[model samples]
Target: MNLIRPDKIIVGMIHVDALPGTPNHQLSVCEIARKAALEAKLYHDEGVDAIMIENMHDTPYLNKNADHEITAAMTVIAHEVKNAIRLPVGIQILAGANKQALAVANAVDLDFIRAEGFVFSHIADEGMMNSCAGELLRYRKNIGADKVKILTDIKKKHSSHALTADVSLLETAKAAEFFLSDGVIITGNSTGEAVEPSDLAGLKSEIKLPVIIGSGISNENIYTYWNQADVFVVGSHFKLDGHWTKGVDPGRVQKFMRTVHSLRQ
Candidate 1:
């Protein structure tokens, strides 16, 4: 479990284009893997601190236990990405497939996973998502994947929290910390949206685990969040025209990395 220990880490996102069996699957698995490996290499060369691979293009993601085809395709892509870079690599299966991600991470020797619905219940686009900390941790233990870290997302994106309105974000973070999450992630309402600065401050004050900002980080705004978050997980801003739907633009990645390095100094 000896992972990146920097006070602040910058994670570039490798949103693996839609995999086989998903709605947007356009290329073969080999093609997808090659594209992902290229992106990982680009991030590594650009001096990114770490990288995370996510199924972001798989629109209309499934709930827990995504299709076996999705898992198989991801495993192949992750293996390629891991082999292509030296930096710590993580995986995130879209929707709330925590255990599936763990399985894929374990299979491909990934360092960590971004898990949604690790604690507490909320309505997601997929459906109602119940807390999976108990089942997920037990499964992780049973599968002997303890070395893989699980960073849980609290009050995650693309969801409604009316049920947890009585509980504060800090309280939800506390629940995640109590549940033994290796880290806690905070995101905006949806993808590519900036997280509230006050929310990051509140979570840092209330939680002891590492705090990661999961979306909407760009070269233009890195300085504002550089000191507040332990990790900045960026995706959309690194793509062409700053859109998530586009492919990773190496120039954008380099510019963001330069800004991050300057701020780090």
Candidate 2:
């Protein structure tokens, strides 16, 4: 694995999931593709560091391989978005689809990937996910895809950490560092909720790797975590009227941009 890079402001998320075959999330890939590319391009235009494409809609999560339909749709969209935006591109395949995400990134020349359960087990809405850091790292090296960094979810969303209760969040983060994760992410246990400042503080005390605020970052509280987190993957807050299923709210994205830019000033 390559060394993790800090001192960056990566921001983006996968907001569309109702691709060709899936529709539960109230969006089709066709609807989301052009719109999401335009939205991501807008963020790039605002000078955000990096953008990640994910399948945030294929809900009722599966802890394993997603149907080829989901992967194919994301590949097409990721390619289009990469072409549209100037910043680094990344991908996250929903429901613990790490290998598939890697495959897609490789196919589309994405710069990185967000992997859930990169190390240790977690009880997700779908079920348990065992650590794949050892295998994933080796696989990346084997396939000569080591240049693509893996931003691991230290304590991922939509899950319970009771299984790792004896293990502190920082401890789990340490294991990921040792296992060679390029960076770590902290979530609020679900979408649209901010990661606890205390949790962020605790993890910060333990690791030097790049840390990201994974979910619930928005115009309201992004200021709070801006300096603390290297990147912010925001989605729900950027949607139309604050609804995750609605179209990209350029107004919301602009508001976040203004807030973040003000701090730099």
Candidate 3:
């Protein structure tokens, strides 16, 4: 069965609280799981199509290869959130922890994962990120988690793409397709920034893969990219005051879903 339907999907983000071992860590694993599940429940009640749990608050993230504790903490939180909501759920570990995210997803029976640096190289705030399509997919298969979809970010946010400046966005997307990415994500320069509509249009016209709008989708502008995107990964817009670091506001979610529902018709 295709987990990501052909119809437009609105994936709400559950920014998992600071996990143990991270500098901002304070909450116990159980407490973090409780908070995440609460947000998941809210998203479900508010009519989101799916949920994506992320360790966004785990500041000063490792460039790659998250520690065992981080992985363990995420596993607990993902499991709890998955149980709290019936919608398709996914997870993303910070700073390119694709393999760890996959392991957690596989263990928790998650529907998918949002991966960074699935193809090509880029310099992120965390550090250099290299293509991991081959190893990541292989690891998925090896772990018997082929059922979990890997949605990758191309020209990821909060990073400089100067290293691949010679390569056009379309070329990078084609490369991802060539490497067998389940889907390719398009994002702006930083978090909560709106993706250029023309960029989504370009990929939709040329690529056969599902094109996901990864950032800056708000209730107001959903109409602009509605026709072009297959999936909208909304985070900040649904949070209180449109801030990623704040708690999710039920009112914001309802308002955004209202716009999305209208677009679906």
Candidate 4:
């Protein structure tokens, strides 16, 4: 896999509500891809170092097979997004769908993947997710997709790792590193919620691998975690009216970039 260190990484999030095969919000599959691809292009133009496309708006996500249409649709849109953007691309198929994400990365030439359970799993919005490293790592090998990196999300968004409550935060980071994760991401419990800087600090101390903040970054508290986190994944803040469901907000993107640049300088 091409090296993508976290410190210099700034990712623009593109949320597509529509499932791969079906129309979402009254839009056709092709339309959904067009909108998402265009949004991806916008993020690239805004100077984000990377773009990750997720089907966040698609609700009631299944842990098993997506209909043929869903996979087909995701494949098509992912292809278009790759064509439109010059930056490295990544993908996340939600609800613990690590294999699907790997498949998408392979089909689309995405640089990396954001999988829910590349290591251990706890209760998630979908249910108790089991570890997938066994199946996921082998699938990647079988597909001949060693070039794509897998960026695992530790204690992912919209869920809890309470089942692992007995485990120390630092221990969790150690476990992820031992699993051979290329990188690890830390996110708030839900979208736009601020991740406590202390959590990042603890995770950073335990693992030598690159760490990324997965959500809730804005112009406000970004500086607080700047030193702890190597990469920042931003989405809602860059959306219309700061709404995740709306279109990309160029002004917000520019504003956030300015603040981040100021800090780096």
Q: Which regions in candidate 2 have their CA more than 4 angstroms from the true location?
A: 1-8, 23-32
lDDT of 3 by residue, 1-265 (tens): 2534656899999998888888999989999999999999999998888999999999999997799999999999999999998999999999899999999999999999999999999999988889899999999999999999999999989999999999988999999999989898999888899998777766777988888999999998999998788899999999999999999999999998888777777
Each model's backbone clash number: 0, 0, 0, 3
lDDT of 1 at 104: 93
Which stretches of candidate 4 lie above 4 Å from their native place? 1-7, 20-25
TM-score of 4: 0.93
TM-score of each: 0.97, 0.91, 0.97, 0.93
lDDT score at residue 167, model 3, on the 0-100 scale: 94
Candidate 1 lDDT at 148 equals 96
* lDDT digits (tens) for residues 1-265 of candidate 4: 3333534678899887667444444677788789988888788777778888888777777763456666677788789899987888888876677788788889888899888866666877777787777688789999999888888877777777777778766676677788777788888888877787778766666678888888888888888988887788898888888778888998999888888778767
Quote the RMSD, in angstroms, for model 3: 1.1
> Candidate 1, TM-score vs. the true structure?
0.97
- Cα error, residue 102 of model 1, in Å, equals 0.3
Cα lDDT of all candidates, in order? Answer: 0.88, 0.79, 0.91, 0.79
Model 1 lDDT per residue over 178-252, tens place = 999999899999999998887877566677788889988888888888777788898999999999888889999
Model 2: how far residue 131 lies from native, Å? 1.0
Misplaced by over 4 Å in model 1 are 1-7
Model 4 lDDT-worst window of ten: 1-10
What are the per-residue Cα lDDT tens digits for candidate 2 across 1-265? 2223443474766475566555575556676788768878877876666777877767665786788878888888988888897788888887888888888888888899989889889888888888899888887887878778899998788888888989888898899999888889889977888888888875665787888788888788877886677677887887887767676667777777787778767
All candidates in order of TM-score, best leading: 3, 1, 4, 2
